[model samples]
Target: MAEARETLEEPILTGNGGPTDLAAMEPDLLDVEPDQTVASGRRRRSFQFGWWLACGWLILVVGAALLAPILPLWEPGTPDYTNVAGGLSASHPLGGDAIGRDNLSRLIYGARASLLVGLSAVVLGAVIGGLLGIIAGYVGGKVERVLLTLTDATLAFPGLVLLIAAVAVFGASMTVIIVGLAVLSIPTFIRLARATTLVIVQREFVTAARAYGARPMRVMLREVVPNVVLPVAAYGFIMVGVFIVAEGSLSFLGLGIPPPTPSWGSMIAAGRTELLTHPQISLIPAAVMFVTVLSINYVGERTRKRFEVKDSNL
Candidate 1:
């Protein structure tokens, strides 16, 4: 009797082996038992708390960027001739770089650019690659062969080196940098989306939609895209964290955005010269990057786990 109730709730199966009349069924699909409802609410609260903790670093960096100019702090690019070697104090809490620019100000400003590049690259990669992956997986055969080959070739190159070379070729602007990383990031998203879609396309729900004579495009969009998007979004957070550190590294190497445009990497590179004398300049940015990356990874993993629903054919 319980199995019959479960089957009725899901409506994925019918005694006649035909697609169920979903229009007549209630949209809620499954009814929530009292115990199950309470457990779900508890889980939701736990997830919200985890997100709140994750957003803490995100909020801090964005707030720091927005409030930077208004703060009593010295401008990032302007040199403070009197405070080169001065350790942390009321005026300069993070101390001064070799050029005597305020460390706190530069760190805040660098974050604005670093995060912008990271997030922009992730969105670009996810959109372009996710679309192509969906096409490849749904259409399969010749189309899949051609697109996968191109991605594979791009994947074969040494990523960071290719990025630097591409930057070197394109003149190292923010737009060029984003393109470089997005190109590298596409292959990963392509593989993930394609793998997920292959499984989804074979599901009974997908077959039933096709049996109902729904156009291929409509079925793919209405069915496949929704199911695959959650996992892709979960993975995007990790990509953002990665691209952030990469941008910082490129800046450190002097191939990042040109001077006077504060970046964590360039700041760290500038302080390397004075490391023996004053290590605080580089350490502050490093600490911020470390904490941000760790937080992003933890939150991303948790989100992925929370969304790991086994495909239901009930």
Candidate 2:
């Protein structure tokens, strides 16, 4: 009796008499588990933190630039010549340098030169290196070997040493300093761009585009270049911080932008002699450089992480 009843029940369930509605058959499929919800919430919070950090640094840089004209800071060439008795007073918040110029004013003015060198070097390096990298990565064979060899040779030299040698030979000026930094940074961009291009060039989409008789230029610009831009942009941000610090160091060592122009590096150099007695002069500019570089590095790290997450999801 038990076996006969089991056979009859199985036939009813297997035939058209079974439940027909899709929603009724799998109700649990639509429900989200607690763990999934918690994980998603954590991801959202992390993304928010990254965005805020990046925005904060951007605001600081922009605010300093905009406030330069309106602030009651000293002119770049103007001499403070005030007595040491007025050290750390309200009139001179950051105190006076060895030459009696207000440290605060010099700090503000120094931002212009630092930012200019950093931006210009990145632009020049990215354009030159990016193009070469693209060509080498796509073409491969002998072309790839030659381009990679050249990049490796450039990378063999320490960046600061190259900058110092170039500046020593050419003399200390803004343009010369920028050129030196740019030249030193080109190899990094080349390597990054070439690697990114190589990965994307072998993708299915690229093969399909080529199969459809797309021109080489069109494939590169429309397909390969767009895919690699994010990683290159992240690298550029990190390079900006490096170039800024490099420019400052060059100026501090007397191999950067010439004096009387109120560069942060030169200010630190000038205040070094008085470090024991009036430490504020040197300490303040050093602090500014340190904070700016740290902030930029933080932002760059966050940016890289965000990009990595996106790539994983894709």
* Top candidate by lDDT: 1
What is the per-residue lDDT of model 1 for residues 75-164, given as tens digits with 9 covering 90 to 100? 989999777856788888887888678888889898888888889999999998888888889999999999899989988989999988
RMSD of every candidate to native, in Å, equals 4.8, 8.3
**Local distance difference test, per candidate?**
0.83, 0.78
Residue-level lDDT tens digits of model 2 in 1-314: 33433443443343475575454434333332323433377777876786687668667765776688887676756667783413777888777777677777778788877877888898888888887888889888999899899889989978788888888788888999888888888888889899999999989999999999999999999999998777887888888889888887887788888977777788788888888877877888888878777777788877787678657644
TM-score of each: 0.84, 0.83
